[model samples]
Target: MGFQLTADGFAKTIDALKEHYLIYAPVLKKGTGRFTDTDIVRYDFVNEASEIELERKSDYAFKEFLTPLSETLLFFTEDQVKAADIPDKPVLIFLRSCDLHAVRRQDDMYLNNGWTPDWFFKRRRDLVKFVLIGCKKSYQNCFCVSMGSNRSEDGYVFSVETDGDGFACDVPDTGFVPFFAAGQAADIKPSYVTKNDFEVRVPDQVPGAILKHALWDEYSSRCIGCGRCNYVCPTCTCYTMQDIFYHENGKVGERRRVAAACMVDGFTNVAGGGEYRKSQGERMRYRVLHKISDHKKRFGENMCIGCGRCDDACPEYISYSNILNKVTDAVENLGKEVQ
Candidate 1:
C-alpha cells in the first residue's frame, strides 16, 4: 500500500530476510540426477537467482512448507502421550500466487476450518513467512485463469521484485511499523501479471451435476490411474499413515505420514483388504469432482489453484481444466441438447 520500488532494491531486501528465516525457493536442478524420495524435503537448485528456473512454475508447490509431507504430530508410548516438535524455525518460502492461494485453503483447513488443533496451530502460527513470486507467462499446461487464484497479498511478509540496479522491497503497511517506520516511501511494486481469459465457475451443486453428465465416463476412460496429478498438485493434501516396528526394540516404533492420491492404484486398500472406486472411471470422477466441487463447497474456493501441474504431471494428457470447460459449455447448451 506504499510506493512501488525499483527492482534492485527488492533483491537486497530479501537477501537481508534470509538471516532471520531460511528461504526455500525455486532452485533448478539438472534433468538427470539423484532425486530425493521425500516430496516435502528441501529442493536442490543449481543456483539462487538467475540460475533458478523462473520461466515456468515448479512442478511442486510450496504446501510442504506449511503442512509437511511427513510430520510427527505426537508420540504415544504405553498410554503416555507427548507432542512432537513441528518445524519451529521460521521459514521463508518463495511461491506463485496460485500456490499461495492453495496455502490459504490449507490454512482454512488447519486453522480457520473449525477447531484449530493445538498441534497444527503451534507449527503454523510460529514458523513461516511467505515471499510471493510473480507469474510472467503460462508454461506447459497452466490454467490459472480458470480457477481465479492467480493473485494474492494475504500471506507474504516481504514482497519483492526486480529493479534496474538491484531489487525492490515492498513492506506492507502492517509489517513496516516497528523497523521501517522512519524510512521514506520505499514501497515496492512487484512485477504484474496479465490475467488469463477462461474462467471455471461451476454451479453450487456441481458434484451432483458433474455426476449426471456423461462426460465424466468419456474423459476418464483413458485414465491409467497413475496418480501423478495428485503427486504434483500444489493443493492436494491427502495423506496415509503407516507404522513401523523395529526389529531390535520390539516395543519401540515410529509412525510415518505419506502423501496419498485417490487416483493411485491400490489407493482404497484398507485393513480388511477392501477397495473403493476399483475402476479407473470411478477413481477419475472422485478426483475431478473433489477438486472442482466438493472442496469449493466447504472452503468457499476451488482447491485447484489452476497451476496446471496436474496436466503436465499426467502421462496421459488428461487436463482437468479441459473437462471443467467442456462441462460448462455443455451445461450452457442444455436448450440445444433438447432441440
Candidate 2:
C-alpha cells in the first residue's frame, strides 16, 4: 500500500517503528569531511523523518552496520575462548536502489560463498531489514544506470522519498501498514533514476594481455594508495584479522576482524617479508578485476553496483567510470589485433 504522509505524520510513523526496530539512515555530519568546515553524508541511527538526509547521496555505504569496520569475533584467555555478543534487537537500514542491489553481493559473499554460511554474518543478516530510499534524480558521479542497479522493485519492506512539503511512502509489507495510519492512502510508486549524468562501458571480457597493458601504469603514479575507494565501496568485502592481547604474556585478548583494503599497503604481505602486487598499479588492477571480472566469473554477475562512491571519495579526482571505459577500449583494441 502507498501513503502520502504529512511531515508530522511521517515523523509519527517513524516514532512507531522505533519501538520495534533500530532505524538507520543517511545523516549529514558537519565538519567531519576530509576538508575543513565541510560536511559528508553517512549512515547513522535516526529517530524522526527530519533526521534523515533524503536530499544528498550518502558518501558512505550502509554496509557498516552489516560488516562493521572493526568487529570483535571472540575473546580468548589462556584456557578459554568465548564468542563476542551482539545486540538482539532487529535493524532497519534505509538506502538507495544501488545499495539495495549491493546487499545481494554482500549476501553472496557471506551466505553463499561456501558450503556453510558465516555464522557471525548470518546472525546479523537474519535480524536486518531494508527500506528503499527512492532516488528522485541521479547524483553527481553516479553510474548506477549503467551497472543495472538503478531500480529495486523488491527486497525492501517499503520505499520512501520527499514529496513537496511532506513525504511519499510505499509500504509493501502489511505488517508496517498500521504505523502509517495517520497518513492518507494514495497511488504511489517509488521514484528511480532512468539515466545517470554519464554512462560507464564495462567490457564483456578482459583479456589476459590487459594485465600487462600500459593502462594500469597511469594509476601507479596518480594514485596515492589512500584506500578511500575500497573503504567506501559497498561491495568490497576484504578484511584482516587481529588478535588484541590484553596481558604482557598475550594470553588474554580479543580477535578482531578489521576491514582491509586491497589497494592499501601490507594487504598482500605474507611471511618472510614477501608481498605480492606491491605496486599501486598492480593493486589497482587487482581491485578493478575483482569487482568486474573475478567475482563475475564466480558468481555470474558483476560485483560493482556502480554507486560511484569510490569516484566521489578519491582525493586525487581519479574517475573509476573513466577507467572502466579505458578498459573497454583496450579490450576492443586487443580484439582487433587478434583478427
Cα shift from native, residue 7, model 2 (Å): 0.3
Give candidate 2's TM-score.
0.99
lDDT of residue 224 for candidate 2 = 95
Residue 11 miss distance in model 2 (angstroms): 0.3
lDDT of 2 at 237: 95
For candidate 1, the C-alpha RMSD (Å) to the true structure equals 4.4
Tens digits of lDDT, candidate 2, 60-89? 999998999999999999999999998789
Give the TM-score comparing model 1 with the true structure, all chains together: 0.81
For every candidate, C-alpha RMSD to the true structure in Å: 4.4, 0.8
lDDT of 1 by residue, 114-217 (tens): 65554554466467677676665655566676676766756776555444444444566475434333333764555545556444555444524455667767
